[model samples]
Target: MTDVPAHVHEFDWPDRVVIGTVGLPGSRTFYLQARTGRRIVSITLEKEQSALLAEKIDEILDRLREVEGNRYSVPTSTPVELVDNDPLDTVEEQFRAGTLGIGWDPTTAQIILEAHPLPADLDEAEEFDAAASVNSEMLRVKMPVGTARAFTQRTREVVDAGRPLCTLCGHPIDPDGHTCIIPES
Candidate 1:
């Protein structure tokens, strides 16, 4: 990471400070909050560097959010369509032909159709409905388990923090005596 330019305001305030600077490439804005409870730091870049840094920061933040919560163990379910008589053989054939690609696991499968921005005629979307019917195979599509788990955890956290609810029935429960009853199956 590049260092902040000297011309940028560097304040030693006990509470909070806002700094701005303009360098060779672009300008930057920074907000530094020094509190007894928690310290917060936010930085913003201006032009080309801003876009690049924003993308990098977004990726880093996404990974961090995923890691902060224990949400790496969620399985995503995909819809599998069974065609005619032989589902297994058709799925195998599609996989072998590379038309239907599988992800890290055999469960995650997707139609490998090219959709590039060149040769508009060739870029037409291929309809797989007829092919899927004739193939007589089951489509095994899989979703990213880790991503889904992380998202679910994040959403639950947000809901919990914003509006407290009963863990069992999702109803508004008392903050103090919120008992969760688990019925025997």
Candidate 2:
């Protein structure tokens, strides 16, 4: 058995970072890709994870904007020039993301995102220390306010582009058919 080197694909300021999918809506595979120039890192993620990440990022930015004397320039919406709607570049799955983390960086006024690979031992504790997880492979990304806003905007659009919801049960309707289990009144 050979050892796989623990790699940390970090992008301080990427030119493009977006959540995109491959395949049809119901059977689609979600991916989080970040690129700086020619270097690109793509990590597979679940649809729920992608949606929650975007929501949390927006919540953080919204809170920051409400700060009484906020020195940072937090945009209320994605900058017109920064709005990215292009398809993801050729994806090469580096790993399937298990633990996704996001935070705000005040000093640089950037949003930080980290994606850690699934642990080898499924039974082990899931808590992760980004600084201490040196033996694992992960991707770390930092982006400014404008870029972060754009990311969340694009991500929301991608997530919503999936199967339409059934108004009766609020569940996604399948392409073939949908059996909504309507609740008894």
Candidate 3:
């Protein structure tokens, strides 16, 4: 087996970028893809990674709009769709996310996202150094604010398409049965 490389890659303005999933609902695998012409880079990340990115993006855009109002800058609206040619156009992942960083580029009106790999979750063990695990590798993707917002919105939609949650408990309701927490009558 080949070892994963450690490096930072920058995609200034990719032709297409999308977050999508594969497999059945209970076993879906979340992946992020960025394509420039024929060049394609696909990275698989935990579901939480995608969800958090979406949340952060919404938060950032909201804050930016509040600060700048309709005055600062935003490309005119267009249909927001997650576009990808054949899911997993590439087989292997550049890296799975350990941590992700998001930022707004005022000059270019771009939303920048940097994904770092985590070899181990900190809560897994005391020996696991979260900081050290964080800097293992980085994959940075930069796209316009409109595109970023679209991706975030579509990603959240895809994520929420999973199993339904129990009304009594926030946990997913298994197909077999849900161990819901309810007050005894």
Candidate 4:
């Protein structure tokens, strides 16, 4: 609700926006990347954050579709043409994301996502507001509904590509070994 901060890396209708990662499954580091033409911004985030971001975006789209006229053109699934299965372009961490924001813009019918850097004071991390007009650098991206759907699809795939889940205890099975310890009933 404030002026666009000078530290904000804003991408309006980016050419490409995705959640990608580097390193192997268990030790992998997730990144949210947005590119408009030659300019690209990559920010590091947690694997769980990536998963939740995708899920929330999809939920927003689903709710938008349920609107009476369905005029937003929200896709039920990722359009085949927008599917991006390629690896990340390059690895560069602009910042470590501590807070994330997601919302819809009715005028443009675009989904907006913002990633804010972690606070210097670990104790104040909980109080940092990503949406507030603070003098902090952040990455903000707005993409159409189709691209949003595609982004969520890719994000879910990337998150799932990590360690497999144990059938019994429902915990990730690490590469070395996994012991599923069932709790007492």
Could you say which candidate leads in TM-score? 4
Query: lDDT value for candidate 4?
Result: 0.90
- Who wins the lDDT comparison? 4
lDDT (tens digit, per residue) of candidate 4 on 46-102: 998999999999999999999999999888999999999988987678888888899
- The list of candidate 1 runs beyond 4 A from truth reads 1-46, 68-185
> TM-scores across all candidates?
0.18, 0.88, 0.77, 0.90
For each candidate in the order shown, give its overall lDDT on alpha carbons.
0.28, 0.89, 0.74, 0.90
Best-first order by lDDT: 4, 2, 3, 1
Residue 175 miss distance in model 1 (angstroms): 57
Give the per-residue lDDT of model 1 (tens digit) for 65-101: 4564524332332113211111111111111111222
- Candidate 3 lDDT over 112-141, as tens digits, reads 998777665557656745466554667788
TM value for model 3: 0.77
Better structure of 1 and 3 per TM-score: 3
**Across residues 38-115, which tens digit of lDDT does each residue of candidate 2 receive?**
999999999999999999999999999999876788999999999988999999999888878898888899999988
Give the range of the ten consecutive residues with the poorest summed lDDT in model 2.
125-134
Q: Give the range of the ten consecutive residues with the poorest summed lDDT in model 1.
A: 83-92
lDDT of 2 at 127: 72
**Best-to-worst TM-score order:** 4, 2, 3, 1
